[model samples]
Every structure is written in structure tokens, then in C-alpha cells.
Target: MQFSGFFSAAMMMIVLSPSLQSFPPAEAIRSSHLDSYIRLPSFQVSTSPDSQDDRFSFRKAFEFRNANECGFADHETTGVCDPTLVHVAITLDVQYLRGSIAAVHSILQHSLCPENVFFHFLVSETDMETLVRSTFPQLKFKVYYFDPEIVRNLISSSVRQALEQPLNYARNYLADLLEPCVRRVIYLDSDLVFVDNISKLWSTNLRSRTIGAPEYCHANFTKYFTNSFWSDDRFSGTFRGRKPCYFNTGVMVIDLVRWRRAGFTRRIE
Candidate 1:
């Protein structure tokens, strides 16, 4: 039942830019039209010189039967704009494609209203839409291409090269990538699978908070920073009067309405 360690361990292997670790606005930053900067190339597994051995293949016929409690028949007829639908966002790449598929399967299997859930997938590769549809023919999903160049300059050196990948920061720009009608969304990491109905998590109330997640106040927050950061009052003093805690970015319920209104993505850059 304890998934904290599992999530933490999995996340350690998948690195993200240090900028994404905390929330603070940079000085005089401007937002760019990410859509115009990066293009999703055609699906070519062999394009990379070393990609010949890195082909990804999944079961072409993986399907999940919905529970009777799930009133799915009507949901199929409903559009994604329908207020009744639950929106879930996840990233898809070669490294985590299998885990992402399994996570989708687990959600559908356990959800009481499987048909009401619509997925918003952030992908950097081409032909991902075709791949996802082939796996789950009945799935309600759409793919958004996240350009790596959008965050390349914002990223700093990390312990692992994987953490510095542009796709890892894609979560930081979900508000800009998804449809504006999707006011709320559950951003899930591709590495984990769920045993419970994801809709339960989707329905959580953020209240006045821009985002909500399990916070670990007991964990040492200072360890995430460096001696130089702590040594300087100008940098360390930012946490004054505020109680900071550790929260895994792997799972979160984000209020995109509040996020966009506040211009959080611009600040993060």
C-alpha cells in the first residue's frame, strides 16, 4: 500500500531540471510560442544512428473490459468538452511507453466510470497517436507535441543526463499545451501504475491552492539545496515565513485555470 518509496526510487532514475524542483519566478522572463519552435518529426525509430537496437514494441491487442458500475455507454457518445469527463495528462516517450500503457490500463480496469476519463498525452515523438490508439482502440485520448527547445536554455546541469532532457519539463507547461476547457487535470508520471480508480484523485478539491499533492513536512527540505544556496541569505531567505515541504512531482492535481491566470509557466522559465 505504501507507494512513496516506489515513486521516489523510480523518480530518482528519471531526472528533471533543478528549476522544476521549486517554484520561483525568474526576473523579466518572456514566454515563447512552444508550438512554433518545435515540430514533431515522423515516427522513425531508426532515424537515430543508435536507435536500431532501441525499437519499442508493445502488445498490439491489449484491451480492458469495463466494470458494470462504470456507466461507460453514454460517455462514449459524450464529447471531451462535456463537464462530466475526467481529464488525465501523462507524457509518452520511448523509455516509459510501456509503463504509460500499463498505467492507462490499470486506471480503466479500476475506475468506476472508465468511459468518462479522457487522457491528454504529452509526447515528443511522432506516430504516438497511432501507437496509443492501436493499443486501446476505445480509449479517449489526444496527443500534444512538447518541444525540447522550449526549455533547453532554462535547464541546468543535473546529476543524471536524463533529468536534463527537455521532455521532463513538459509538465511545467501543461496549462499552455492542453485545451483551455480542461480547467483541471491530474498529471501523472509515466513510470507508475494505479490500483485505485484515478477518478477519485481527479475529483480532489484544490480549494484555493493552485496545485495539490501529498506533502511531506517531516522530510528535510534543506538537503535538496546546496551549501552555497544555504550560505547566502539572499537565496535561502526566500523560504522565510513559509513552511516548505517535499512533494513528489510524479502525481499532482493542477488547477490550470488558476495556473494560467497567475502566469506560472512564464515565471518558471
Candidate 2:
């Protein structure tokens, strides 16, 4: 069952961002008026016109921007975890290290979940060994790795290409190596922590839809994915063609069955 050396592969990417409160009220992010604007993927730092999507901004969609005057780490500072995060896949694909996992624990420590629920992890060769030995010894989940060389081949011809995976590379590709039993999963970024229980969040409904995410109240979402492709058709259908709903990749319930049935992964590619 193991693809082993046949396919290791590579890539990094962007998805969505969340709010900024442990007990995050949607109202806080709503105030950002992000609802009024379709947040496009752009570089965190800008140096040239050609470097707009330079970093994995879109992949960081689940992270929260600090609104507090003093900057540090606060579990509740960003968006709150959904009540049903358990039903989905809580995953982290490690490219390097940024204490994102610590942040994930900050919330999960308090958020409730089924004892059997598992936290999936994907990491690079450099970090994979340490990840299991250091922080995750008995956390109740399976950790897997791929030939760094294969990942390199997917990108170029050397495993060094894997060194550049921006941020959301894991979430964007984790499902590929997942067990067949995992037909659907909710992907959450490590930057987030839950202030409450997530059992109910996983239970969120899909209703044959490919995914279930909070619909945005305003802003033409079509532009978010369109502006880059020169045509809005890429994800013009992400929200069923309705005005973009506030779809946060940090917290989304995806129907893998539909995702596979409709080739959602191919669409995202």
C-alpha cells in the first residue's frame, strides 16, 4: 500500500485565514470588512510588482492577524475553533518550524474531542524525526513521511526543492497519501488553537456539496482566485457561484467523496 519511493513529490501553497480571538466572535473578523473585500493572496512582504503572490499567502488563510496592541502569542487572539473540528482531519504538514504546533496545542488543550480522534502530521525529512521524538510521543495519531527525493522530483530533480514549501503545502496535499478510510477531512492550520469543543464542528453538514465553509457576507470572492488566473473561472464555482461566502480554509469541512467524485483536487490544482 505504500507508494514508497515511487512518489515523494513536492509543493507549498495558500488557502484561507481565520479571525483573531480565542473565543473569536465572527463579529471581530466581520469588522475587518474582509467581508466587504475579497482577500486576495498576496505576499506578506512586497519588493516588486512581479512578487505579489511570492509567498504562500493563500495557504495561510487559516492564520489570524493579531488585533491587540502588544504583539505576542495568545490562543484566543486569532479565530476560534469550530465546535465540530473533530469530524474532519486536523493536520499539519511541516516544512520547517515556527511553533505552529505549540499554538495548535494551545487551543486543542482546551477544546474537547473524542478520545479516538487522531491528529495527522506530515513533515519533511529534516523535521519528521524530531517531530515524533520531541513534541509528539503519545498524542494518539499516525505520522508519515515520503522520500524527500520524490517530493523533489515532483518539483525539480532534487529534494532541495522541498525546502521552499511556503506554508499550506501539507493541507493542500495531505489527502493524497491518506488512508482510504479517510474519504473526507477538515483541514486546519497549526497556527490555530481551539478555545472550545470541536466535536460538533466535524459534524457540520455537506449536503452533497463539495465543501462546507462559512459563506462571506460581501466582497466578490470570484476575484480572489480569478485575478491570478487572468480568468475568474478557476474557483468561480467555489461558492457555488453565489457571492463568496466567508470560506476559511483554516476551518473547512470538505466532502472527500465529492471532492474525488468531482475531481475537486484536480480543480484546485
Q: Which candidate should be chosen as best, given TM-score against the real structure?
A: 1
Q: How many clashes would you count in candidate 2?
A: 32
lDDT of 2 by residue, 79-115 (tens): 1222222333443343212234543444445444333
TM-scores for every candidate against the unseen true structure: 0.71, 0.48
User: 167, model 2: CA deviation in Å?
Assistant: 5.0
What overall lDDT, based on C-alpha atoms, would model 1 receive against the true structure?
Answer: 0.69
Candidate 2 lDDT (Cα, 0 to 1):
0.42
How many residue pairs clash in model 1?
1
**Cα RMSD, each candidate:** 9.8, 15.5
Candidate 1 structure, TM-score to reference: 0.71
